[model samples]
Target: MALLTVKNLSVGYHTRKGFLKSVQGVSFSLDQGKSLGLVGESGCGKTTIGMALMGLLPDNASVTDGMILFEDQDLLKMSKKEIRQVRWKKVAMIFQAAMNALNPVHRVSEQISEAILAHDADISEKAAMKQVESLFDLVGIPQDRMRDYPHHYSGGMKQRAIIAMALACHPSLIIADEPTTALDVIVQDQILSAIKDFQNKLKISVIFISHDIAVVADVCDNIGIMFAGQLVEYGRIEEVFDAPMHPYTKSLLASYLTLDKDVVQLNSYIGETFDLINSTTGCRFCERCSVAEATCSLVAPEWVEISPTHKALCYQCK
Candidate 1:
């Protein structure tokens, strides 16, 4: 069975103008020990999906429809206390802005140890610290640095610490939201490698959220290309990338620089984006889509299966 299954999960925020649909009918599944990447442009609700899965959505945001099923249990139906128990114990998140996530005042060891103790109350501080040490080692951080503060650590180390915290409780699922943002290229590669290595070694299911298509493809087994708060295409990374069926997905790849592909006209999808607040019927990506026709703007596109494992939310492309 799938470790985590999100069925038509929709999220909206109450804005001054109207309710903004941040995520609309987003559905996908992650198997044990596998990784699923949610890739899209900023403000497309990639992070919102991750936040929803973690039950950490802001007060203004609300889940309007759909269910979040983790291990066949509906997380959306859980009470606050029930979900709190599930949060760090079963599912954890490595939030964006690693530096800000850490407490500058607390020692790295204290913060992670506190997290472990918060979940497993029976575990002593000493034992929790031991687990933190192991996690630090697992994420390739030196153990001596555990005693230091977040400010003492470098940017890469800070990210590693955040990853370590996410894994401290041995959660079944980890939702990583833009974990590689604002890091040097070398550090970014290292962080990606660490996430992948531990994911394979520990048999952990991961939902990696990123705007970078190349980065997502690097660490994820399956990929979901999101746009305007919906998944445009989804399948095995190779299948989706090699045989892209969504115009937005193709545009994302075309915008990405890859050595294997020949130099092609870069499709810079510049211009006005789809209106999230008002339009609810037509396909949101139609305005920016390269192959969109008159019918695309008039009728909403539905998921068209191109293969058993591959699908696209576009009729024209299919």
Candidate 2:
């Protein structure tokens, strides 16, 4: 059975003008110990999906339709208290901003320990601290620095600390949102390596959300390409990368610079951006898609299955 399965999920935010649809009819499944990456441009609803899965959407955001099935149980149906109990114990989140996630007043180890105690009430404080020390080792932080303040750590260390906290509860799944946001290239590589290492060693499932295609390509086993609040393409990394069916996926690859390419090629999708506030019956990406058909602006595009493992949302691709 799949560890996580999200089906036809639609989420929107109530704005002054209208409801801004952030995610629409997105569906995917992840098996145990596998990693799936959600990649797209800004305002493409990548992070919103992650937030919805974690049950951390803001006050304005509402899940209009969908089923968030984690281990065959609907997360959407869980009450606030049920969610609180399940959150750190079953699913943990490695937030985007490391500095903001960590408290400046407490020691790094203390915060992680508190997370551990909150989930497992019977665990002694000493035992929790011991586990935090072990987590520090797993994430490559020195044991001596466990008691140090957040300010003492660098950007990479802060990220590692957050990852440690996420794993402190020994959850089955972890949602990482832009984990390497402000780090340099070298640090980013280190962070990615650490994530891969623990993911393999611990055998934990991960939902990686990032705008950086290369980073997602590096860490994820499967890739889901989102566009204008919809999943435009989804498949294994090689499947989608080798034969991208959607124009948006092709455009994303064209814009990104990979070492495999000798001569860099960039395709600029020139058109009006889709308005999230307004609902569209036709293809939302029709206006910006380079190879869009004459009927694309009037008709909705259905998912075209290229292979058993690969598919895209485009009539032309069909």
Candidate 3:
């Protein structure tokens, strides 16, 4: 069985105007020791999906339909207490903004140990501290610097500390949402390398959410392209990058400026942001698609096979 399965998951937020659907009919599965990257524009429901999986949705938001199955158990159907038991022990998350997530008052080691203690309350503090030190070593944080405050650590170090905390309980799955968002290129590469190394060493499943296609391509074996709350394309990274069937995926690749690609004018996809409140009956990318047909605006597209392990939700592909 897959480590994680999200099937037809729909999430919505309550607003002054009306209920706004943020994610709709999203489905994907991840196996053990594998990683899947969810790539999209900022408000395309990438983070929302992560939050939904973690059961961290706010008061105004909820999972309206579908299921989040972790290890064959439906997380959506679990009680709050039952989910809490699984939160850090079974599945953990390295939240966005590592600097802000860490408490400024406590030392980094204390915070990580606290997470361990919280889940395994019977464990002695001495034991927890030993585990924390080992985690520091695992993530490349020096043992002496374990007591340093968040401000004492550099951006990359802070991110590593947060990662250490996430791995404290040895979770089977890790959800990293925009983990390298604000760092410099060098620091970003270091962090990515650390994450990839950890994933391989521990053989952990990961759902890496990011907006940068290049970064996602580097770290993930599988890629899921999201547009207006829907997964438009999904397949092996090599297949999707080499031969994208969806127009949006093609545009995203064309727009990305890479060092290896020849110099060319950066192309932009022309269209307004997708409307979440009043969604169209047809393909969400119809308005922005360069080769959209008349039927694209009137009828929703179904998943069409592009290759054995590749599929796209576009009529053109069919």
Candidate 4:
């Protein structure tokens, strides 16, 4: 059975003006010890989906519809107490902006120990400290620096520390939302490598959310592209990267500069953004899609399987 399955999941935020739908009818599954990449432009509901899965959505936001099934348990139906138990023990998250996520007032060791204690009550303080030290070592941070505050660490080290905290509970699933953002390429690679190494060693599943298609393409086994609160395409990473059927996916790949194309220019790329507040019954990408036809504006596309385990939501593909 799949480790995590999210079906017909819809989420929205309540604004002063009105309710704004952010994620609509999104569905996907991940198997044990596998990684799925969630990629999209900003405001496409990538972070919202991550927050929903972690049960950390803001007060203004709620799961308006759908189910999040993790190991056969429905997360949407679980109570706050039940969800609390499930979190960190079964599922953990490494949030975006690691610097802000870490507490400025507390020592890093205290923060990590808190996570460990929450998951395993029987663990002694000394034992938890030892485990925290091990985690720091695992994530390539110096063990002696655990007493330092969040401000003491560099951007990359802070990210590493966040990863360490996420792994403190040894959860089965880790949802990392843009964990390498704003870091140097070298530091990003190191963080990615460390994450992959830990995932391999611990046999953990991951949902890595990022706007950087290149980074996601490198780490994920499967890729799911989101556009305007909906999944446009999902398939094996290689298949999606090599032969993207969706116009949005193709555009994303085209925007990237590869080694083969040393002086790549994006003169043909479309520049349009979808208005999320306007409820559109038709294809969300129709406004921005280069290949959009008249039918795209009239009828919503159904997801059609193009190859084994590959699906695209486009009338043209159907």
Q: What tens digits encode model 4's per-residue C-alpha lDDT throughout 1-93?
A: 999999999999998767788999999999999999999999999999999998989999989889999999999999999999999889999
TM-score of each: 0.97, 0.97, 0.98, 0.97
Lowest summed lDDT window (length 10), candidate 2: 258-267
**What Cα-based lDDT does every candidate model obtain?**
0.89, 0.91, 0.93, 0.91
Q: List the residue pairs that clash in candidate 4.
A: none
TM-score of 3: 0.98
Quick one: best TM-score, which candidate?
A: 3
Write one digit per residue (lDDT tens) for candidate 1, span 1-318.
999989999999999999999899999988999999999988999989988888888999999999999989999899999999999889998877556889989999999999899888799889888899889888989999999999998999999999999999899999998999878899999999999988988899999999888889899999999998999899999999898889888888778887888876776776687788987588888778777788888888988998889999999865
**What lDDT would candidate 3 get against the real structure?**
0.93
Name every residue pair that clashes in candidate 1: none
Whole-model lDDT, model 1: 0.89
Candidate 3 has which clashing residue pairs, if any?
none
Roughly what TM-score does model 4 have, to 2 decimal places? 0.97
Error of 3 at 62 (Å): 1.5
Q: Tens digits of per-residue lDDT for model 3 on 71-140? A: 8999999999999999989899987755698999999999999989989979999999999999999999
Candidate 2 residue-wise lDDT, 260-288, digit = tens? 78755466779777899876789988888
Task: Show how many residue pairs clash in every candidate, following the order shown.
Answer: 0, 0, 0, 0
